[model samples]
Target: MLFFLRMRWHWIVVTTCAFLAIAGTYLLTAEPTFVASTQLVIFPQVSGSEAQRAFAEDAFIEGQLEIARSSDVVGGTVAALDLVHDPEFVDQTPSLQDRAKNWLTGFSSGNGANEVQAQTEEERLHDWATAKLLNMTGIRRIGSSTIIEVSAAASTPQKAVDIADTLARQYIQKNIAMKANAARQYSDWLSTFISEQQRGLADTASALASFTSNPRDQFKLAELQSATDARRSLYENTLNQLTETKQRITYSMSDATIVSPATLPLSKARPRSTLIAAFAAAVGLGAGLALAMIRHASDRRLVRPHQIAETGGLPFVTLLATAKRTRNGHPPRFLAVGTGSSTTARPVIPGMAELSATVVGLRRKRRVVIGVVAVEPGGGASTIACELAVLSSVSGAKTLLIDAAAQKSSLSKAIAPQSSSGLADVLDNGELIETAALPLSPTLKFLPLGRVDTVSPAIRLSSRRTQLSFVELKKEFDSVFVDISAFSASPDANAIAPELDGVLVVASHGRTSIDDAMRVIETLRNVGAEILGAIINHAPKSMQP
Candidate 1:
């Protein structure tokens, strides 16, 4: 419960953080991304020629479209735009190189390119251009037509448009250069072969004529004529091949053309602010819940009186959730609260009005011995012991709060700071118990912790004098509440608690650990202490500032 109260301050922090976190994500992920796109005819001219290629396949269209959208093409576009000079691209250049260089690098590297080193700045620039080009590149068959759609994205509308335009122009020019070179080479080769065949044909024809006209070569006329015919056939074939080559070059010239040009997009292509903000808010909420649960679980402190009750199988007799802390940091005031109902304010002593009640109850029942114990120190157990005495005494019962713990002096000082001697002094040094006992009110009295001049044994009670004093104090009084130390695996509470008519175990919620509370309870039970039940002091709840 204290953990829950502590989280009250967290709500404001969470709200502020969540809002800022979502806003920050929007700022990061949401950006103006202008996408420039254009439609290309895919030069449907050749696409129509392949009879086996169904219109449904759109294979050629898809292949070219993919190439248009490919990283190389986009990279080329980014390079043409000199995006390398952009610092963002520069910083990312190295990572781009790494991705292109390795197989798994694509998964690890964001841009899916090889890492760029300072020495290879140009290469990095090229890679960055490539990555952006790939991102901006979107290629698809134009509704099953040979046509294709091409796009590029940039921060500004003009940049997106310019990139798309540049890519289209550059790719077309490159294809032209390659095809023209091939065409020129073919034309030259065919022209050369045709020339060779023409020369051979002329020589064969001349030889055949000479053989036919000269008597000395009459036997060679038929063979020479056959040779001439073969050469003529070869020359005719070369001429035909040259005509076909020219026709192919003419056909390829117009096969691929950019029919529609790219235009700048008016808006950013990405960085959806609403979507990013929503995603961020969801992530923040989940993380906040996890963090809250983690912190609460780690705090290990007991949170409520009920936690103690459940841990020890004992009902909580009393609890003080928000008792005021002392100057020394322990609970200064005393509270006697019950279950279920919330305690809003600590009731003023009201001139021992409650003291009047406990006395009446005890007197009516003829109570004898009383024991005061705690699950742990710093739990205000001592404070409860002192207040109970004051109430009892004021109510007309001769009450004595015996300082049974030989270890410390907090009880005497806080309850009766001015008193110089107490039960310890009287028991250990034979100081007069009657003198040490202080008169706090007409009905209430105090027993101070004895003189510092005498050191008592750490373990046992002050002495037989204090023991006999307890016996004497109890004779006329309805109850003698012994303020004992927190439980140890010893027989002292055993010796004293059984003699008491009842025991009231004082414990503070959220201060005591479960193990400590259990050990104390078990020890008291072993001592055969009359199980008068438990009191959880300083109960769960936050204190007002």
Candidate 2:
């Protein structure tokens, strides 16, 4: 995970920066909203302890909260503040949807519709204001308590405070009005009932007086007096109820009281800039890491040392760091190993010395002929072979470096560019190795690919004559390094690999895939080739000495 993070650090930084830019843009362009809240304490106004106990229930408190958020309360507040004309409640400018609707309907359609349209427009404006107020308003009961919280959000702190306070006031007034209306209705009903009772009492009293005037009707007079007394008592009770109901209408109280008035907000309620930016950064970083991991999983190129064995199951010979280019944009051809400079290329590479020593150990059997091959072109096989031969020759052994890769004779071009005959001529025309080979030093000799118009190295490399030539070269030189073509480029390496004493597989760092290297190794092993080890050449600076 850490490796991938380092490899794709720039991508992560870029993604995070892009998210931060979006957050900054929103912070700069988004409008700010302020919230103000008021609290109301609800209770019963009736003159009884039972009413108060019932009012303490959560249901009663919830009902009061609903009333505070109702359309009636919100609309009353809008009318009280004349919010229909206020831009915060109802925008004076028409929206694009409104304009489009008007265009589709054709505004100049009929006459005699002005007054009706004006009335409808006024009603619509009021409804819009009420709806807008309701949307911005929030009413909730505070826990299990009798207190209700009413909050309103607006563009300005003062507007938010006004809306919240006005809505609370309207709710209180509506409650008082409802109580007053109930009391007035009761008073009217009691007055009419009392008037009917008074008439009945008068008739009973009249009947009682008439019966007393008759001397012989004593039983009828007593019965009439009893009936009249009961009627008088009922009339007095109805009159008292009327008086109390009238008083209640004059002094009606609200069920809820303002315990906490709305106050002006100090900060915006939305668009938390810092938190938004932090969240965006986190999301972007995660996304970048996911992308990096995906890319890393798909990539098969070998970069580190452990991957050589883990991927291809091949023995790690050594890693050769790429040499820095000289002033002319070319790598130094042949700097000695013990030189003071670390910038130039050396003939004695990091692992080549050990490889040369291993080859020299094999020289006890008369002669050692080793071939350096690659899975693909540009794996620096020729460079490794040349360096190996140079190191061997420097160690006082008679070394012969052969450029048998006829397709790409890089060694021949670099060393024996002037030579006209090489292994190609030696294999085709029976030319001797000593005649075709050029002298690089007293101990080292070079064999170029020479002309190949008449001979193909892939077909001739595995021939009987080529095997005899190898035998003669082995008898003559103590060490022979053959540079074969890439296995992907031609069949020459496969044909020539088994004939050599041992073959070194060359793979380029960061360029050669582990699968390709493994395939080459498997092919060589199947062809009865004597495998020595492997070399990772042209490694990046991080893997350098």
Scored by TM-score, the top model is 2
Model 2, TM vs. native? 0.70
Per-residue lDDT tens digits for candidate 1, residues 187-206, read 89999988888888888888
Question: In lDDT terms, which candidate is top?
Answer: 2
Q: State the number of backbone clashes in model 1.
A: 21
Please estimate how well model 2 matches the true structure, expressed as its whole-model Cα lDDT: 0.79
Q: Write the per-residue lDDT of candidate 2 for residues 1-83, one digit (tens) a residue.
A: 66566666777888888888888899889989899999999884333376566655655666677777788899999999899
What's model 2's lDDT at 223?
84
- TM per candidate: 0.63, 0.70
Q: What is the lDDT of residue 321 in candidate 2?
A: 69
